[model samples]
Structure formats: C-alpha cells, structure tokens
Target: MAEKEAVEATVTGNDQQVGFRAMVMKQAIAYNLAGSARNDANEIVHFTLQGDKHRIDSALATLQEGTKRSSDIKIATTSAAIDPGLNAFTIVDWTSSSRNITNTYNLVFELRADDTAISPTDAKAAWHQILEKTLNADDLKKLQPND
Candidate 1:
C-alpha cells in the first residue's frame, strides 16, 4: 500500500464565489482523498486533503492552476493528522449569519441564537426581524448626513 499523509491548506486571493470550493472537492475526490474545503468571511478558501502524499502533491499543483473564475491564487500548506474516519471530500460552510445570501442559502444557518437547526426561511425571517427592529425609519434618518 502507498504511504498516506494529510495536509491543511489555506488559499488566499480571489477564491470566493467562484466555484473554487467545488473544484477542490472534485480534485480531492478524483485523487481518492478525504477531507473538506470552506470559505471564510475574508474571502479565503481553506482545504484539508488526506490520502497518499504523492496524490496530495498532485492536487496541490492543480490547485495552483486555479479555476477559470479564480485568479491570483496562492496556497500555503501544513502537515495534518490523517483522519481515519473521514471517507469523503465535502464543503464546510462558514457558520455565520452575516454571510451573503449566495453562500449562506444552501448551507446550515447559524445565528446568535445558536440554533443550527433553523430552516433557511426561518433564518431569513429572523434576520429581517432583527434589521427591522434595529434600523427603523427614524434610525435611518438619523444615520443620514445632516444637510
């Protein structure tokens, strides 16, 4: 059997909202690796790839190539402990309500209430309520510049 290894990589650049996570997942699956990818609020994508060391290196090279939608891709990798229980590659969504709808809609919704079980509709409604209460017409007028 081949030697197995794992690596955690942080990719910085124009990596968000560009199908970058999906591309990483596909490459990891193709390499028979197990781990995950996620995007942070700062627009960086992180990856955990575990399998054969050589295959991981290959995937890293391909990652350097970047997707058509991604540019200025830069990756820094570190050794990681192999996860014997991880059997597939997946995308880990950021756990924040402040994320834009494009990224938050399809994943789990997290809020100050600490309820991850809330449906998307409920989450949206909760956010709307918070905004309505916090930013009434008077508040908006106050925020406006005094002319």
Candidate 2:
C-alpha cells in the first residue's frame, strides 16, 4: 500500500460563516480521507487531511477552488503526521460560548495525536471534562483573549 500522509491546513479570508467547512468535509469524504474541519475565533477555518497523498492533493485542489461565498481565500498547508485513528472526516463545532485558547489547543492536540486511537469528538469531550473540573464558565471567559 502507498504510504499514508497528512497535511495541516489553515484557511483564512472569506472562509467563515459560510459552508466552506462543510464543503471541505464533503470533498474529503468523497476522496475517502480522514480528518476534520473547524472555524476559529479569528474567522479562520482550520482543517486536516489524512490518507493517500493523491487523494489529499485532489481534495486540496477542490478546497483551493473556493465555495461561492468564499473569496480572497488563502490556504497554508504543512506536512503533518498521519492520524491512523481518524475513521471519518468530521466538522467540529466551534462555538463562541467559551472561546478560550485551550479549546483550540485541545483540538489541535487531538488532531495531531500520532499514536492514539481516540477520535476528535472523544478527545474534545475529555478535554472539556478537565476544564469543567478545573474552571467554571466565568473562569473560562477570563481566559479568552481580549478583543
């Protein structure tokens, strides 16, 4: 079998509040890739693609093409460690209820887990549990960077 590869992609500009993440998920699924997509506090869309290099490249092509609502799209991709645990592509929810940097870090750590079998959803839930034990909602709000 061909070596499985992965890429960490950060997409900015006209990528948020649209269906870009969902569209990317669809493309990734069509390509049979495994990874995730989510929007960040700064209106940036971050995603990861893991699987065959050719398929990843194909998905990247479609992503670069942009959705109808997307303009000025800029995507930066770096080679990433393959996550063998990701069984399917998913769109993670990034709500503004408690937008702390820790949430992003947790998601990043989960996505980059090279030796674990935990899914992103499971990992995020576990991270939330840690936060629940250590901090209240008000404390989490304090951790959010000042606008």
lDDT of each model, Cα atoms only?
0.62, 0.64
How well does model 2 score by local distance difference test? 0.64
Candidate 2 lDDT by residue in tens digits, 1-147: 656899999997787655577566656545666788887767678998888787788778878988786798888999998766676666676333334333322222223324333443454354444345545466566543221
Worst 10 residues of 1 by lDDT: 107-116
lDDT of 1 by residue, 1-147 (tens): 778899999998877666677566656645666788887667678888887788789878988888787899999999999977776565675322222322232221122222122343443354344334544354334321210
Give me the runs in candidate 1 sitting further than 4 Å from their true place. 94-147
Q: What's the C-alpha lDDT at position 64 in model 2?
A: 92
Which pairs clash in model 1? none
